[model samples]
Target chain A: MKKMLAGYDAVAEAVKACDPDVIPAYPITPQTDIVERISEMIADGELTSEYVRVDSEFNAASTAIGASAAGARIFTATCSQGLKLMSEPIFSASGMRLPLVLGIANRSLSAPLSIWGDHTDTFAERDGGMIQFYAEDVQEAMDNIALAYRVAEDKDILLPALSCLDGFILTHVQEKVDTFTQREMKEFLPERDPVHTLDPSNPTTMGAYARPEHWTETRYEVQRAVKRSKDKIGEAVEEFADVFGREYGLEHNGLLETYRTEDADVIIVALGSVCGTIRYVIDEYREKGEKVGLVKPRVYRPFPAEELNKVLGDAEAIAVMEKDVSLGYQGGLAIDLKSALYSNGSRIPVLNYIVGLAGRDVTKDVIKKVVEETKEMRGKDPSDIGLEEEERWEPLREELLPGDKDD
Target chain B: MKQIRIHGRGGQGSVTMASMLAKAAFETGKESQGFPSFGVERLGAPIEAFVRIDNKKITDRSQVYNPDIVIVQDSSLLKLVDVEKGLKEGGMIIVNSSEGPGDLDLETDAEIVTVNATDIAMKHLGRPIMNTALCGAFAKATGLVDRESMARVIKETFEGEIGEKNVKAMSEAYEVC
Candidate 1:
């Protein structure tokens, strides 16, 4: 059915359609409604699932781990501080290879504690071993939850997954979403086939202690599964396309999505919903005959290095745009992208433009300024605009186009 | 493309108003998006929500700085923040107050439309959730979405007797415009 819903409701409905057996919920702003709606569905007898209102995010995540290990389909959600609170269980859930899904309503990691949208919350957990799917809108949030289950439950890739959507930007925003019937949903996302279970009849010790010698191997196994999940994501989305008639990327389910990068002189790279804003800016620039394009990395976990090396290979410069910082390091996406480029032997200069932390608006003008700066460094060493050893900055927010509002 | 900015304090349903407006617009075959500004969630704090209606899908996720319409659910906020900031010249603003256009002495050429939405909401719904009432004002003020669409969305949103009461509040507010 075609209906309009906020990103939160869309995700809640998608989780409901997955027919999850258990949901461990903690009320966090922005993310609170996703659970709230699901609770309503359960209370209204529309969805039959255990909605456990946990005391803390830590318990919420631990509950997911417990439920998933018991061969039950599981779902959970958190944001910002809540995400940090659940970090311990997040890593354990993936290492144990539990096929559950966590919805990360993206928010700024707090020092002074802000509830606005930013990538720092999810970005901080990149190495935690959970498959990360960055959704740019409501449709993607709905479809990605299905895709998350399809990819994570693959026996070869039985790992936990997290889908990140910008906090209020997408989570609170209402947009049109085309829902699926139970039959269609079952066809798209089949019943979960657990690889191992915690039953007394066929007990399997999960997250068991690994000695020093086996520790490295255990870590490598999760890394390998994460890397391999890249292809599984593509395969799942391919089947999703056959059933749903909507394709997310070229040739793959969606490693990264490229826009007009084929012949552009400067390529812009970004993640999450900011890519939509970049598209609007690209359109304005292209209308004036500027050779600028955009590359959106939908899967930040696998890092999409090969796709990045190839899609931006022909461009004169690469502009890495993000809304977060790696603290002592510069932009998180910028650093990872630079590492990807260097490992892939790309010599193209990469400019880092960090914008919109604490929900500072990333307007068309801010993007235009970043593009102009990247355009200036066309043939310079990639090091010129690359990450420095000691630097932390907010380029578009503090530098260009300072907002009219006081921080 | 049509952009509208809604200004209201927390607990006033400004965000819901934006969502309802988007739903109504989408029901009328226009692609629409609605969202609220993020901060510490609180009651009585100033909050702004935006709605964009276009023939094509909207891509710009930035805040609506320049809008075709500005809606003020609380007229007192007009003196607090620049409720009319970046409104297009000769645009329109619908204020939720009993004081008609003459009492609203804003120094803009934009058209001013006033309805006592709070009074109407209390009169019809027995509560002062003026969002539905203001939706009626918005429907009549700009015709961005039809009165029928607004009624349908309000009914679909509230349901049963409460929905009928909201529909009445909306219609009564729309009538004065």
Candidate 2:
């Protein structure tokens, strides 16, 4: 049913519809609202899940791992410092092949503390063996909760998954979301039947120590599993469309959704909530007869390289806009985009724009500037575009930073 | 899309005002969105919230830089914030104050309307909170949302005796405004 709901509340509703057996999560900004709603649902007798109150995010993930090992479907959430604290157990969860859903209200990491939204926390754990899905808005965020659980619990793809929503941008924003009924959700995602479980009477070793002989093979198996989960992700997305009757990834695969890219020359690639602003800007440019389009990555972990190339191959230039920077390198999406496209043998001029860090507003002006800069790279040598010594900080205030360059 | 920005103290329910306005608009068959400022809010500190209403899906997630309407729940925020900043030329401002528009001395081409929401709230709800009263004034002044829908949303949000009292304050403020 369609209801006006906050992003967090919507995700919590989705979680309730999925009805996990156990929920072990600690409170953190942005993410706090989601867990709070679940707590209320459990308290009001609307849900019967075992809500585990943990001391920290570390215990949250550890408890999730233990519960999932005992054949209980699990759900938990955290962000930024909380995610950093939970990283160790998260990796362990993946290595142990425990399938559970982890909700991440994507927030910026801190030396200088900030409680705002960004993708730094999610990208920091890119190496961790878990599936990642980035949502564009509240509806997608809600849908992805079910999708993540569906894909995670597949007997073939028994890996932890993250349903990431931008902190305040989507988490706090209120919008109309169409949530599924529990009956529909149960049809789409049935109760988990684990391939392996921890029974005290007949205890079997899981995530055991790997020696030199077994270490390489075991890690390779995880790598292979993640690689194989891409198809499972696609299948789940298709099934979701059949059940919910909403095609999240229309005309394109569920991995990378393309917006108005049929004949566009400059296509901006983005993840999460910024895609909405880019779509607005694209409409503005379209009014002026500029063929601008957008490609939003719904699935980030399997990286959607081949699917992205199919839609982006004909574009004159590509601009990658992201909320997190890799510090010494370009934004994570840009780095991944370049590598992905290059491997596909498409040497398109790709412009990397680092924007909206720590909840800084990425307005239409920033997106327009990206398009203008990307337009300049249409026929230029790819090597000549980013020749400047320093990274390009779009919409940067030179006066505030102690920089010599005067604009 | 019609954009709106609300300014108030942290404890005064500015965010709640934004969300309620959006919900009212949604009740009237319009798509709406509401979100709070990125600032870390503390009680009594100034904070801002935004609302957008349209016929179609509201996709632009950027903070409202140009609002067609601005609502000031705490008139004291005038000294600290440019509540009129980026207001459209022919837009409107609904402020919670007993003073006339000329006395507020805000430098803007937009029209300013005042409702003594504090007095109305104190009379009906026995509190100084002006969110419900200001929302009533906002509905009466702009006509973007009807009083009936606003009252329904207000009642849906705050139940029992408190809801009826807020609706009373709202109706009184609406009458005066």
Candidate 3:
């Protein structure tokens, strides 16, 4: 039987089923419900986990790190500023290879302090050594949590994992999610075998500063473990599919899901929840006989280069939509996509359209306009088009009351 | 697919309501999805929850821009947010208000059903969390799930005497609504 639930509730239920020994989280906008629910479960005796209400996100990550180092399956959640605050511990968790799973409610980093959805927070930590997986919706968020744990705990890939979800849009939004029963999850992920634990019986010093003689090699070992996570994630995803009846296609490494791209002149590449809107627009345009499609990159990190190249090779033009931007540089996702295609030698006039930053709505009309504009620009000379320069970064218009003096 | 949107504040049980609604729908052999939208972490800020129930698989993951039913846990939201934004013509609006259906000056042509969920919640549960009460009224108004099934789901979700109190509150709200 299937039921609908809020994204946070779904995540909470998944976390409950996973039965992590410790959950240390500092509540933030959009992600507060998840921790709140988990805390409630612990109080009500529904969950036997140690619910740690930490002072800050830094503490939350540190607490999880401590629990994980103590050989217990641990979990934590944060968003936006919280994630930034927890960066030090995030790196420590990865450096120590603590095998912790953190739920990141992807939110916009504040300058003007917007507590909405965006990829900037996650993008900032791209090189943190933790395997990152972007979830498109609530169900994916729930599934990714369990998969993240499995992959992180794998002996070959004993690295931490971060599952990203759009803060308010995906985190707080309610949707139908296929929540696995505790029994089902147990079947999917077996009991953890404490390999390198901080047990008194086996005293092991974790995160010891190695001499320069072996520092480079230790770093190389960490890199190798992170690289191995690519396969570990794929294997865990496949195993999850076998048990849950939902396949993530994680094995298809450069796995970019193409929608209606067959015989398409223009294609839009996007990630996270915004891709769903793009898919809707593509479907509508396809109905109107306009050969347009969407190339949704499932794996954002370890950048899916070869797969995106093959999927986008046939298109005359491509539009990359990003929900977050890196000031002075191109949008993070757009830049990554551009680099992915660069080595492929496919100069498919890729236009970068940064839309829906900080939780602003990206309507189907906006997606349609992007596709139409991309198609029109494809007719111009490659040099004249200047795909990068063509991007128009307009400030978001603030809605003012009828007689507001601020306006 | 049948999409239902619930509007409430942060302290309200919009998330719990969506979960119970989904659980009830699931009990009736329907595929259902539920999620919530919260702006700030603070209590009493406007929060929204969504539920999608379908006979087949649910592919769409976007917010329910167009809903077949709009469950308003806070009547005050009717003045703040566009509560009736994408409600279908014949769609139902279930408001947990002390006001009667005729009392509301709703501009839309959709059916309006009102229940004083707060009163029932406070009277039965001894608190102001009207989510379970509103869920009962929602089931009563839409017939999306039978009252018995909703009560059963509520009982299973809650525990001890609180579960029985919520069930009674739901029954009272259903009858009154």
Candidate 4:
């Protein structure tokens, strides 16, 4: 049951256990190994599925959409520029209400060109109507695949799902993963029985054109279903724990997870593999009698606002460390958390620390520095630390940024 | 937890060496993780990989900055990069070279262990794939993983005659260490 597996291989193992009806293959850094393993499984007769070879990620998404429309459970993976190339289909796949699970080896988008770990890819598609789940480690990356399928396929919440794992960090790192048998996985998630599909005999239109009159209502319905999916996802995670014997989220099966935040004064909120690093810093600080904790949001879409408020609101100061930026604004997660706190009528000092971009190492020392800064910002206004713009590039190499020729 | 860093050229199997070490540690009933540096690697380019072994689950995803031990698969990398950059003061480094520890000019507080892994590999496998041989030297020098566990993983990784060749090269390097 326990084996040494890289995150990509672990994801492939989960996909094999789930046994989707169709797999469209496209190669990209980090995510390519996952589909490569799936193809090997199909070719080796271990899995019975239609393995479609596609030249581009756009075709991969299109193929998955077509297969899902035919009432077939679908599995596909892509990230970064590939995800951007599949942007149109990604939106339509979710809009058409296909229960396809998209595995994203989260990577930074390129202009200067980078093939490293970041949240930019998935966070860019945050509003595309797909349910988003960010995994903290190799185990969660594998577990999220099955859990995303279980939740996304629910008739009431028939939205596509994105199971995102940090590129290279988790995808390439080999660690212990407790794999599940096909029988046990099937017991938890039975075969997909779609509520609607494209049938010629009993035809039902999908991805139909929405007129101006119907556009608002269609958008409303999608919004309503996504908002309502929070409960469905919570229930599915509980059932997943019962079936798989692996429980997620600290305290309970909420969208976000809390680590030692019950009595902490300073807490940092982050997502994906970086949370593991932050947890280590928390443990080290806790031993030194410092009330430092971490709040990791496993689910990004349906944005865990209320849950974020619950775990982080009690802290004297909250710092949101993220690998993404909203460009000219602040880190995406920090922007959202600040809005959520503001809506909850809480005036906590939340500092935004943008870090670990383009595979820059976010070491324990960087985290320790953030904690110290958060400690300094305690009980201070946003402007007090020159954070009114909500941007703090912690650990930034100043010379790298465009500045004056001389200091 | 014990952290290890491996320095080698891109084609020298540094990443595989790290993974094999971690797997060997796992075979000894310890939790372990291994991964390559986030570098744009190509053949013959200098690169690094890392491994972490612990009694409990290894959760930190950061690269091994302060390594408890260092492994250099190429003697050339000694002049190219700081192979012992963040090594602990009393840590040890296992280098694959024909020269003695005195010949390799590395100024560090760590102990230096040298083995001519290329010769061992050329003798057994007819190639310069010194990763397995260096792994054997690692086991002998550090005793972090036993020889039996290291051989088992090497055999599992490289099968049939190649596996046997690798094990022989490993044992030869182990004896030299």
Residue-level lDDT tens digits of model 4 in A1-407: 98888889999999999989999989999799999999888889999989999989999999999999999999999999999988889788777888889899998998878889888888889889989999999999899999899988889988889999999999999899899898789888988998888899998888879889988888888888788778877887788888888888634455878889999999999998999988899999999999999888989888888888888878889888999999878888888998899889888888888999988889999999999989987887654656455678878788777998697
The best-first sequence of candidates by lDDT reads: 2, 4, 1, 3
lDDT of 2 by residue, A236-332 (tens): 8788888999777744558878888999999999999999988999998999999999999998897888888889999989999988898877888
Question: On a 0 to 100 scale, what is the lDDT of residue B124 in model 3?
Answer: 93
TM-score of 4: 0.97
Compute each candidate's TM-score over C-alphas: 0.94, 0.97, 0.82, 0.97
Q: Where is model 1 more than 4 Å wrong at Cα?
A: A386-407
Give the true-contact fraction for every prediction, in order.
Answer: 0.89, 0.83, 0.43, 0.85
For each candidate in the order shown, give its overall lDDT on alpha carbons: 0.87, 0.90, 0.81, 0.89
Interface RMSDs of the predictions, in order, are 0.7, 0.7, 3.1, 0.8
lDDT of 3 at A241: 80
lDDT per residue as tens, model 2, B1-177? 899999989889988999999998998889999999968899999899999999999889899999999999888889999998899889999889989998995877788999999999999988898889998998899888889999998999999999999999889988998
Residue B13, candidate 2: Cα error in Å is 0.5
Per-residue lDDT tens digits of candidate 1, residues A1-407?
88899999999999988899999999988799999999999999999999999999999999989989988999999989999999988789888888879998998877867888889898889898888999878898888899998888889998888888998999989999898778889899888878778999976788889889888988899999999998888888788888888788846448888888878999998888988889988988899999999998889888788877778888898888888777766787888887888887888887777788878888888888889988997988866754443232434234556566867
In model 2, the runs with Cα more than 4 Å from the true position are A386-391, A403-407
**Which prediction has the highest lDDT against the true structure?**
2
Candidate 3 docks at the CAPRI level of: acceptable
- Which 10-residue window in model 3 chain A sums to the lowest lDDT? A392-401
Q: Write one digit per residue (lDDT tens) for candidate 3, span B23-80.
A: 7887777777666654454588888888888887554555678899999998998899
**Alpha carbon lDDT of residue B153, candidate 3?**
85
Error of 4 at A198 (Å): 1.0
